[model samples]
Target: MFQRLFITHPASVGETYFEHMRASLGTAGKLARASAACLVHAIVPGLCKTTGSTAIMALHSEIYPRRFDQPTL
Candidate 1:
């Protein structure tokens, strides 16, 4: 059960559990920052104008090559 819940996904992605945890945390942090910046920009039109899109693009570049779009890997 533990293996199915934790180990399997990380292994499928060629990462250990710890590595996957770190990567997920990093992505979450980046998204949080982008979200905050976008919220602020909504109130002040000139502030953080490109922050959200830039962060999304960065995340996509880092994660998109991992074969995530396939039906099976």
Candidate 2:
């Protein structure tokens, strides 16, 4: 069975993510992103395998909403 963790930050979510990844990958561990939140694809064994494990090592889809207001038409 596989489990995922969801993390929401007011700011610097990317930085935090990279930090976690760096630590995890540095130790040669495994982690998965929560499906409900951002689509985080970790470096899992037999999954998306990578030569090195870093927080920002793998490319992930950032689903953050924009703060800018829409222009009136």
Q: Kindly report which residue pairs in candidate 1 clash with one another.
A: none
| Model 2 residue 17 distance off true place after TM-score fit, in angstroms | 1.1
The runs of at least 3 residues in candidate 1 whose Cα sits more than 4 Å from the true structure, single-residue gaps closed, are: 69-73
What are the RMSD figures for all models against the true structure? 2.5, 15.7
Please list the residue runs of candidate 2 whose C-alpha ends up more than 4 Å from where it truly belongs after superposition.
Answer: 1-4, 8-15, 29-73
- Local distance difference test, each candidate: 0.89, 0.37
Clashing pairs in 2: 21-55, 22-55
Residue-wise C-alpha lDDT for candidate 1, range 17-48, written one tens digit per residue: 99999999998999999999999999998999
RMSD of candidate 2 to true structure, Å: 15.7
